[model samples]
Target chain A: MNALNLLRIAVKALQRNKLRAFLTMLGIIIGVAAVITMMSIGEGSRRSIESNLTSMGSNMITISPSSNSPGVRMSGSSIQSLTVNDVIALRNQATNLTAVSPMVSASGQVIKGALNWSTSIQGASPEYLDIRKLEVSEGISFDESDVRSSAKVCLLGKTVIDNLFPNGENPVGQIIRFNKIPFQVIGVLASKGQSGFGQDQDDIIIAPYTTVQNRVLASTYFQSIFTSAISEAASEAASEEITRILRETHRLRATEENDFSVRTQAELINTLNTTMGMLTALLTSVASISLVIGGIGIMNIMYVSVTERTREIGLRMSIGARPVDILMQFLIEAILISITGGVIGVIIGVSASVLVSGILNWPTVISEPSIVISFLVCALTGVFFGYYPAQKASRLDPIEALRYE
Target chain B: MSKILEIHDLKREFKVGSEIVRALKGVSFDVGTGEFITIMGTSGSGKSTLLNVLGCLDKPSSGTYLLDGVDLKSLNRNQLAQFRNTKIGFVFQAYNLLPRTSALENVELPLLYNPSINTKERRERAIQALEAVKLADRFDHTPNQLSGGQQQRVAIARALVNEPVMILADEATGNLDTRTSYEIMSLMQELNQVQKKTIVFVTHEPDIASFSSRTIMLRDGKVQKDTPNENLQSAREALNSLPVTEDY
Candidate 1:
């Protein structure tokens, strides 16, 4: 028989039991939707993390002093062996480095006109803002002369500004007390929101390193040295150059281990991305199980339908329908059900992803490749599961089938 | 008229759990074109087996059967289906019209298997067949909407839609009442006399068998009797004498 006629007959048969056909398609619908939702969510989070890392400066690197004590383990930032001289040495020697700053931080209560807030106070050179990709929204940043003269000028991040000066007050050129020492507000850093670890990024106060070393903490050792490479591709070379300069400046012997650790932003981002990728793969695989189960459900229904329509097969054969025609009829019916379900699934999946993003406030991105792959998988499932049942229908004996009760 | 079907020493056997049961024991017969013949026998008399063999639905174990000069045993499954599509039409005892399908679509079914017929011609031929059966107004109605006799008529129309070489009907009016049975037989009589269509009908009812031009009685897997009806009854006259029912 011609394909169109066969299809029409198959459709007519399916129409006889519309509810059963829809129920059979339900399995495939749920499977495809689940896969799409899981994949989109995973992709969204990965993209979010990548954007966050770039915002924090992709080529930025941090160098912290490691504890020199033998057989003792300590947090690298707690050793405090890095000094202003080491930063100067690296700044002069590292060719690939675009900018470098010595960082010293201390937390203290700051008061501005009876508005008091306790926040971390960071001290660094003017290069700190450029290396960290921080911009001044108002007023001016502290210059090199301010760091050399130990000028008591500071910049406040948006969070610190909100906490210390409410009602969007302009605190520029105003005096704010930090540990009972009065400092002039130089500028307000632009907002950076929260970090990937959920920590508030814009909750710090910035001052010249000389002022924090002499007056706030009364210390000469640097806590950490932050630097940025000229370009993303130069990060590794810049890291190596900084490590060599620091080791030489500290005068560590060949046999002695260097008292420093260098970390690149790219490395941290890669580790985070790897973890996210694993999670996405794990979720997608789990969702695919439902698709396989859906295929099995189709097979189960097809077998039942073949058995139910044995007499029909006989009648068609007696009316001059070839075995191949019977087979094509059944096979086309299966494909029609699955492909219809797949199209519905794609719509449901996209809508569900949008709902998740809207209601739960989670990021979700639907990739084109995922939709294409899921559609192909659905078609393959129909063919694979429908084969044996269609074959059984085609191979039936006309005499016995006609006689079947 | 020329002979349309020739059979010689036709035999059919079935293995029933290690024992071979012979269904057709070397039965032979010839049917001429435009002839209306009936093969009559009781249950277990192998007349049904003979019908199946004649319809090309079952192969003979050891026999030579030819239709229009072509060997039946030489044809494969697909070729047999093709042969049936072009050369023979079947009307079952149950009517066997597909349930929930319109009578027009059911009539068009056999033509669907013929690749040479297009959709438009198939429809036109199905309508013509239905018109011949006097069921043109009921083309859109499903089988369930029709009476037993009407359903049988639709089945006959389906059988005739392909314009096959011969019509093979097995107990075509077995489910109908006496009056409806006469009505269907009259229609078959008109088709045989006016359209010159050859027909082979199988039934155990002697009264139904009296309408055919020839009668063949089968017994113990063999032909017990084969003879022309010397006093053939006209179903049209019989229907004219019967009382008309309110449903008709």
Candidate 2:
């Protein structure tokens, strides 16, 4: 028989038990929806992280002194191996280096006209703002002359400004006390919102490294060295050059391990992306189990249908339907159910992803290739599970089937 | 008249758990075109097995059976299906009409297996067959909506829809009352007489067998008697004489 006619017959048969058919399709629907939702969530998070990383400066790299002892645990920036001399050496030797700054961070209470807030204070050169992609919204950043003179001028991040100066007052040229030391606010840094780890990115104050080293924390050694590449594409080359320079300047023997660790933003992004990708794959695999279960449900229903319609099959055979015709009829019925389910699943999956994004405030990306792949999988599920039952129907002896009560 | 079917020494055996059961034992028969014949037997008399072989639903264990000019053994499974589609029609005891399907679509079923016929022709032929069976007005009715006699008529229309060489009916009137049985028999008689249709009917009822031109009585997997009826009864006259019951 022609495919159209066969399909019609199959539809008619399914129409006899609409509830059963719908229930059978529900399994596939849930399976496809789960897969799509998980994949979209993963894609969305990856994209979100990538954008955050780029905004934070994709080519930025951090060099921190490693822990000195083998058994003792120490904070990353506690070691005093990296210093301003290494930053100068990296700036001079690294080919693709655009900006190099020595960083020293300390948390302290800052007070402006009786408004007090505790915030992190970062001390670095004027180029630190450029390396960290921090733009000044008002006033000016501390210049190199300010760094050399140990000027007590600082830039306030938006969060810190809001907390320390709450009266909608621009803090430029205002004096704020950090650890009982008065410092003039040079500028208000632009808002960077939250980082990928949910930490507030705009809750800090930046000052010249010389002032922070001599006046605030009274530190002699630099905590970390931050550098930026000329372009994101050149960050890897810049990292290699910085490693060679730091190794030679630190005078580490060729056979000995280096006392510093250099990490590029690209590495962090790659690691996060890999983690997100793995999560998506794990979720998708779990969802595919449902599709398999759905296929089994179809097979179970098909087996029952074959048994219930044995006499009908016999009657058709007696009339003129070949074994292959019977097989095709049942197989096509299965495919029709699954394909319909798959289409509905795609719709539900997209909607569910949208709903999740809206309600939970999570990012979601609906990919077209995933939809196409799920459809193909649904078709395969139909054929794979429907085969045995259809084959059983086809192999039935007409005489015995006709005799079936 | 040319013989429509010929069977010589046909044997059919079944293995029931290592025990051989011979369903048909060396039965031989020839049926001419336009002939109305009845094969009568009790349950387990092998009439059903013979009918299956005749309908090409089963192959005889050992025999030289021919339908028209083609050897039944020479045809493959697919060819046999085609042969059944084009050359034979079957009527079952339960009517075998698909539930929830319209009478017209049920009749169009046989034509579906015939790829040579298009959709429009299939519909037209089905309507014509239903019209021939006097069910044109009930074309859209399902089997549940029709009476037993009407359902049987629809089944007969389905059998005739493909314009087969012969109609094979197994207990066609077995589910009907006397009047309904008589009504179906009358319809068959009309088709045989006016349309020159070949018919082979199987039944256990001797009264039903009286309407045919010839009767073959089978017992214990063999034909006990094969004789031509000298005086064939008219089912129309029989229906007229019977008392009418309330329409179902």
Candidate 3:
């Protein structure tokens, strides 16, 4: 018989018991839906993290001093190995670096006409703003002359302005006292809503590194050094240059371990991507178990159908239907059930992903590959589970089947 | 008359749990075209076995059987199925029509296995066969909606749809009442006489056997008698003489 006639026969047979066929398909629907939803959620999170990191300068690099003693538990914050001289060495020698700056910080209470606020005072060269992708929205920025003179002029972030100048006063030229030392506000830094790690990027102040290190902290050592590469692809080369120059400036011997670490924004993005990819793989595997169970359901129903239709098979055989024809008929029936289930599953999964994103406020990306893979898996599942039953029906003895009640 | 079928020393054995049951022991028979023959036997008389062999449903263990000039023994499983489709028509005692299927579809069953017959031709042939059995008006009725006699007629229509060389019936009237049985027998008689269709009917009733021109009696896996009937009764006359019921 032709394939079309076989398909028609299979459909007619399934139509006899519509409820049973639908119930059999439910298993596959849920399985495929779960797989798609999980994959979308995972991919959405990875992309969101990448974009958030990229917003903060994808070519940015950070160099922090490692603990002096490897066996001792000391925070990198207390380490004083990085200095202004190392930043100068990198600025002079590193060809891959687009910009470089020394970082120093001191937390203290700032008072502006009795409107006092607690915030950290971060000190760096004017080039620090370019390296960190921060823009000055109003007024002028302190230049290299200000750093050489150890001037006390500062820039106010949006959070500090909101707290210290609550009356909407133009604080660009206003004077503020940090730790009882008066300083003039030179500019207002543009708003950077928040970092990916939940840190408020706008809750700080920026000044010349000389001012914070010599006047506020009374320390000559720097906390960290920040730099940017010419491009994201060049960050690795830039980091290597920093390491070599810092090692030479520290006068470290070739045999000794360097007391500093260099890290790039790309490394952070890769770590997060790996973690989320693992999570997606784990969830997708669990959901595929349901697909397997759905296949079993198809096999079980096919077995029952074969048993129920033994007499019909016998009648068809007597009328000259070959064994292969009977096999194709049943096989086609099982495939139809699974393929239909797969299509419905893809629809439900996409909708479910959208619903989850809307209700739970989670990021979800419905990728095309996940849908296509689910469909192929459903078709394969049908063939794998449906084969034996169809074979069993095809091998049935016509005489015995005719006698079957 | 040209010979439609020939069987020589046909024997079939069944292995029932290490015991060999000889169902047909060297049975031999030949049937000519347009002949109406009946095979009669009691229970366990091996008449059913002979019928199965004749229908190509079971191959004899040691025999030579030919139908429509093709060697039955030389054909494989698929070939036998094709042979049955093209050369033989079968009617069963229970009127084995598919439930929930219309009479027309049931009649089209045999033609479906033949790839050369397209959908339109299949439908036309089915309708023509239904008309031949006087059931063209009720072609859309399912088996449940049809009377037992009407269902048998539909089964006969299905048998005739393929235009086979002969019709093989196993107790075709075994489930019918006397009046219904006579009506079916009359139809069969008309198909045999008017259309020149050959028929082989298997039954245990001598009264039914009287309607055919020849009777072959089987007893204990062997043919006990094969005789020509001198007084072949007309089933249409028999059906007409029966007293009409009150409902009619």
Candidate 4:
């Protein structure tokens, strides 16, 4: 028989039951829409994280003290001993080392006459602002002279100033008492907005490393250590050199691990990105499960159609229609359902993704490759899932079918 | 094998709810070219089953049946379909025309399965077939639009479109009025005599069976009697000699 004639009959039969055909297509539409929407959200999140990490010192490295126990406190193993002596020694010994600052921090209530504010006070050298990309709004940072003399000066972050001042009042040159010690607020750090990880960034005070070390504590030891590498290329090597110097100065032998742990800023970002990427892939794949179920639904409905039309099959057979003709008719019906649903699903899914992203103020990308893959998957599912029913329809006994009421 | 249809020891048994009902017990018959034979039997006497076997719509359980020089038992499903497309035509008691389809398209159905005939030839042949049945005036009407006899005539035209050597009709006039029954019977007789088309029609009525040239009586799946109708022409003449049954 002519292929065109067979197609004509199939089209007419499918058209006879428009409501049933539409309902079947609805299942496929939902499945495909779920796949597209979930994947777009996952992709959007991945891209946002990539850019967020790039903004927070994309090539920066960070080193923190070691905490061997899972929930242990992590100041440092030798928190009471790291001093400016150790900082200067490392700066001189390592070739790729750029700057070093011995840090000491204390949380206390800051007072300025009628106003009082509580915040963490951090101390570092003049190069701390450059390393953290902090901009000083007023007054100069403490230099070598200030570190040597142990001058009591401070730099205030935007949040600390707002909490203590409220009005557009100048904080520079004002005397702010820290734990009852009179220290002058020499400058203020410009606002650095919220980090992508939801951490408040501008709620602290900066002071000279000397003042924080001597005034905040009555001890001769430092609380922490901060360092910066000359360039991104040498950051790893510089970290290793600093580790070697710390281990030797702490009187540790080669076999024994030191108390300090060094962590790179790049490594933190990498771990975060890898975990998010895995989450995206897992979520999208789980969504694909619905598509498989949709395929099964298509097969089941086709089987019902073939069985219901047995007498019609017999009628065609008597008119010289071959078994393959029946098979092709059923197969084409299934394919038409799946492909049509797939097309509508893609449109609906893409629009849904756009709507979600638009309302939430996030990014959504609908890649052409993903669309193509989705359509192909839908077509393949039709053929793969519809094969058994079509074969069963083609193998029906014409005489028995004609006898069927 | 040279005959248009031949059967030897033809038997068909069917099981219904644990009972093995033999529709056709050991029946054997042969039909040569241009022969019009009528099979007469009661409801469960297997006349329709015999026609199914003759039309190649069924397979005899344990018998040798030949149709148009090919063994019916040896042909696969696809081969049998092709053979039916070219060798056999059928008209059922129900006037089994698809009620939704137009007369011309119904006639063209068989020709579509025959690949040797192209579109122009197929349409021409289908029109000629409808013209032969005198349904050319109602070519566009669906089966429900025509009378029972016209529908049967359209079915006959469909059967003739492929120019098969024979047609097997199962109680072709059983559902029609007496006048329409005679009209359909006379059409078959004219095709048998003038066009030399062979036909085998099944019926339970003796008057309907008397219209054919030969009569084969069946009972309990077996041929009880087979003989030439030496008085067929005289019988139809006598039936026609009565007042013409009309619905004015």
Candidate 5:
């Protein structure tokens, strides 16, 4: 018989018991839906994490004093290993770096009349705003001359402005006292909601390095150095260049370990991507177990169908249907059940992903590859599971099957 | 007349719990074209086994059986299936019409296995067979919607659709009432007389056997008597003579 007739026969048989066929397909539907949803969620989180890192400056690299430096180990914040001389060496010698700035921070209370607010004071050069992707919403930033002359001018963050200058008063060009020394607010920093670590990014103050060093902290050693590469792809090269410059400027011997650590945002992004990929793989595997169970369900139903249709098989055989024809009939029926269920599952999975994102405000991305893979898996599952029952029907003895009740 | 079936010393054996049971023991028979013959036997008399062999459904353990020039012993299982599809039609006691299928489709079943017959030709042939059985008007009715007599007619149409050389029936009237049985026998008689079709029917009813021109009586796995009936009864006359009932 031709394949089309066999398919028609199989379809007719399934139509005879529509409820049973639908129930048999339920397992595959749930399995495919679960796999798609889980993978979409995993991919969504990965993309959002990447975007968050990019917002913090994709090409930004941080240089800090290494606690594991040769000699007595020192704590991270108390380490006086980095200096302005190292920053100047990196700014002048590093070929891949586009911008560099030295950082010196001190926590103290600020007073603007009777309203006082306590926040950290960050001291850096003019290029600090560009390297960290921070913007000044109003007025102007402290320039190169401000850093050279130790000018008493600083920028107010959104949180400090909300507190020190309450009642909607603008803080730019106003005078504020820090550690009993008067300073003029040069500009207002734009709001940066929060870091990936859930810390408020706008709860700080920015001033020239010379002002904080001479008039506030009174320390010569810098806490850290921040720099930006020409591009995100060049961060690795820029980091290596900074390491070389710092090592040479610190005068470390060939056998001695460098006293500084170079870290790039690219490294952090890679770590997060690897972790997300593994999570997606794990979830997809778990969901495929349900698919396996669904296949087993198909096999079980096929067995029952073969048994129930024994006499019909005998009748067909007597009418000259070959063993291969009978086999194809039952096998095609099984494949139809699974493939139909797979199509429905893909629709449901995509809608569920959208619904999840809509209701929970979570990021979700539906991928085409997952849908394609699920289809292939469903087809394979049908063939693999349907073989034994179809063979059983084909091998039935016509006489015995005719006599079956 | 040309011989449609030639069987020589055919034997069939079965192993039941390590004991050999000979269902047919050295039986021989011949049937000519346009002949109507009935094989009569009680239960366990090997009549069913002989019919199965004649229908090309079972292979004889020994000896040769030929149907329409094809050696039944030499052909493999697949070839035998093809031979059965093209050469022999079967009508069972239960009618064997697929449930929930239209009478036309049931008649089309045998032609479906023949790759040479396209869809349009298959449908035309099925309708012609149903017309031959005088069931053309009920072609759209499913088996459950038709009477037992109508269902048997549909089964006969299915048998005739492929234009086989022989119609092999196993207790074809066993499930019908006396009147319906006579009606089915009349239809078969009409096909044999008008269409020139050979028929080999298996039955235990002597009254049913009287309708055929020849009788082969089997007993104890052996053919006890093979003889031409001197007074063959016309099934149309027998059906007409029966009194009409309100239930029918």
Candidate 6:
């Protein structure tokens, strides 16, 4: 028989078992939905990190003390050569330096009216806020003079303010003690909660580097050093300048390896993108196991259908249909089921992904290629898995099959 | 008379396990133009196998079979299907109509297999065939909804829709009551005689065999007897002597 007749016959057969057909379609639906949803989640997480990194200026670079920066791991004590003098040198000498800030952090308890918070203490100059693109919410930030004269002033992060002052009372100009020394709150840093590392990003207080060094903690070594390039085109030059300045300030003689490493925000973005892309691919692949299982289900059901309709097959064959005719009929039936299911699956998968993104408040984009590929894969699966049963139906002996109960 | 179908020394065998089971041993027959011939046999006598072979559903193990002067053995699979579509029709014991299709659509099946007939022509021919079988009013009724005799008539309509040279009936009335069976047999008889269409029916009942003009009996895959039904006149006289059954 021709293709039209075969398709008509197949559609009629499928309609006869509507419930079974729908149940089989459900498997493909769930598989496709899971695949799309997982990929969207992974994409959402990556976008979250991207926006976070973007909010902190993309032209920024970080310079930290390192040892040789080669195959061998750096011993923590061996990489402490970075200093404030290096920051001053880069700011003055580098042609593309926009702003330079030397960072030093101290984790200590702050006390006020029985409300205490073990908050991170960040020490930097007023230039830190401009380069890092932070805005003071309620009070002014510290200036260069404060850093030079070791002013007894502080800036509280949003989380620290909330934790220590539960009544939402303003703490600007109010005296709070850190490490048993009293310092007035000079500013309130802007809120930047939940960094890419899942850490509470705004849980800190800021102070002048000299004040932190002299009164808050007597620490000779500092945390990561920070700087910013003048423009997107100038980030590379600025990073190199920081490395050169730090190397010279530390007085690393000839035949000695530089102890500091400089990295750009663009480099961090690339690394993160590659890692998250791999994660997305892995998750999507894991979800494909369900699609394979759905293919197996189609194969199993087709075999039973062929067996059940053996007598009908015999009758058709005897009328005029050839073996190839019979084969095409059943194969077309299988493909119709799978292709219809795949179309429904694509719609359901995309919708479910959107639903998940909406509920979780995450960014997600479903690519068109994913939908097209899903359709092709599922239809081809029907051909591969449904082949054996359709062949069995075609190859049946008419004389014997007609006698089959 | 012009011969429409001729089978010469047809033999068929099957490999059942390690042994060869001989189903037909050189069975030979000829069907003339508009002939109604019945082949009678007991169980395991290979009459059904002969019907399948004649319908191009099976390949004879050896020997030649010709329908409308085209050697069936020489035709490829596709060619045989075309031949079956245009030149041969089959009516089986169980009324093997597609249960889901309406009687009209079931009758249109063979026309669909032949592309020369377009949709409009196919539908018209199907309606005409249904009318010939006296089921025109019930064209939309499915096979399951029709009674056993009506179902058989619908099957005959499906078989006749292609307007083939011959209608091969294999126990066409086997599943019906005596009255319904007679109704179906009368329909077959009308097609063979008034329509001048050749027919080959396979049955075990003597009364059914008497309806045909000739009889061929088979025993153990060979023809036991081949003779014209000279007693058909007496059988008709005796039938009229009995009683008037339902008109149906």
Which tens-of-lDDT digit does each residue in A17-134 have in candidate 2? 8999999999999999988988898889889989999889998999888864578868876778987789778877888898999999888899988789998789999889888889
* TM score of chain A per candidate: 0.94, 0.95, 0.94, 0.81, 0.94, 0.82
What digit string (tens of lDDT, one per residue) describes model 4 on residues B1-248?
24888889999998889999899999999998989999998878898788778877778898999887789899888888887788888787776665567898778877877777787998899899999998889989988899888999998998898999888887889898776788888889888988989998888988887888899999989999999988776334544776854742
Q: Which ten residues in a row have the lowest lDDT in candidate 5 chain B?
A: B69-78
Q: Judged by lDDT against the true structure, how good is candidate 4?
A: 0.80
lDDT of 1 by residue, B32-131 (tens): 9999999999899898888888888889999899987889999999988888888888998888788888999899988888888888999999999999
Q: Write model 6 residue lDDT over A93-205, tens digit each, in one string.
A: 88877788877877788998798988768888788787777889888888878888999898888888888889988889899888778889988888887777788868877
Residue-wise C-alpha lDDT for candidate 4, range A1-405, written one tens digit per residue? 777766666665677678888888877888888888887887788777666655555444455456443555556734455666677777778676666666677889998878888888887788777667678877767677887788998888888888788887899998988899888888888887777686777888888877877788665566666666777667678778888888777777777666666666666667877887788678778778888888989888888988888876776677677888878888888888899999999999999999999998777777777788888999998888878888988888877777677
- Model 1 misses residue B205 by how many Å? 1.6
Candidate 5 chain A lowest-lDDT run of ten = A67-76
Between prediction 1 and prediction 6, the one with superior lDDT is 1
Native-to-model Cα distance after best TM-score fit, residue A108 in candidate 5, in Å: 3.7
Worst 10-residue lDDT window, candidate 6 chain B: B233-242
Alpha-carbon runs more than 4 Å astray in model 6: A57-59, A67-79, A92-98, A109-117, A138-154, A163-187, A214-222, A229-245, A248-255, A263-286, A347-373, B13-28, B43-45, B116-122, B219-226, B229-248
Any runs in candidate 2 off by more than 4 Å, and if so which?
Answer: A68-74, B245-248
Give the least accurate 10-residue stretch of model 3 chain B, judged by summed lDDT. B47-56
Tens digits of per-residue lDDT for model 2, B122-194 = 9999999999999879999999999999999999999999999999999999999998899999999999999
Q: What DockQ was computed for model 1?
A: 0.64
Task: Supply DockQ values for each candidate.
Answer: 0.64, 0.76, 0.70, 0.36, 0.68, 0.46
Q: Global CA lDDT of candidate 5, please? A: 0.90
Of the pair 1 and 2, which is ahead by TM-score? 2
lDDT of 5 by residue, A1-405 (tens): 787778778887888789999999999999889889988998898898888888889999998887656568877678888888888788788899999999999889999999898888999999999998999999899999999999999998899999987799878779999988899998999998887667888998999998998899898988888899999999888888888888798888888877778899999999989999999999999999999999999999999999998999999899888888889989999999999989888888889899999999889999899999999999999999998999999999898888899
Positional deviation of residue B24's Cα in model 6 after best superposition, in angstroms: 4.0
Specify the poorest-scoring 10-residue window by lDDT in model 3 chain A.
Answer: A67-76
Pull out the clashing pairs in model 6. Answer: A66-A259, A66-A260
Looking at model 1, give its docking quality level.
medium
| Model 6 lDDT per residue over B114-220, tens place | 76777789889999999999987999998888998888898898889888888988888889877677777777778887899999998999998888899999999
What's the TM for model 6? 0.85
lDDT of 1 by residue, A1-405 (tens): 677788887898788778999999999999999999999999999999888888899999998888766887898767878998898898888899989999999998999887999998999999999989999999999999999999999999988889887887798988999999899998989999997778898998999999999999999988888999998888888888888888898988888888998999988988999999999999999999999998898999999999988888887888788889889888988888888889999999999999999999999999999999999999999999998899999999987787677
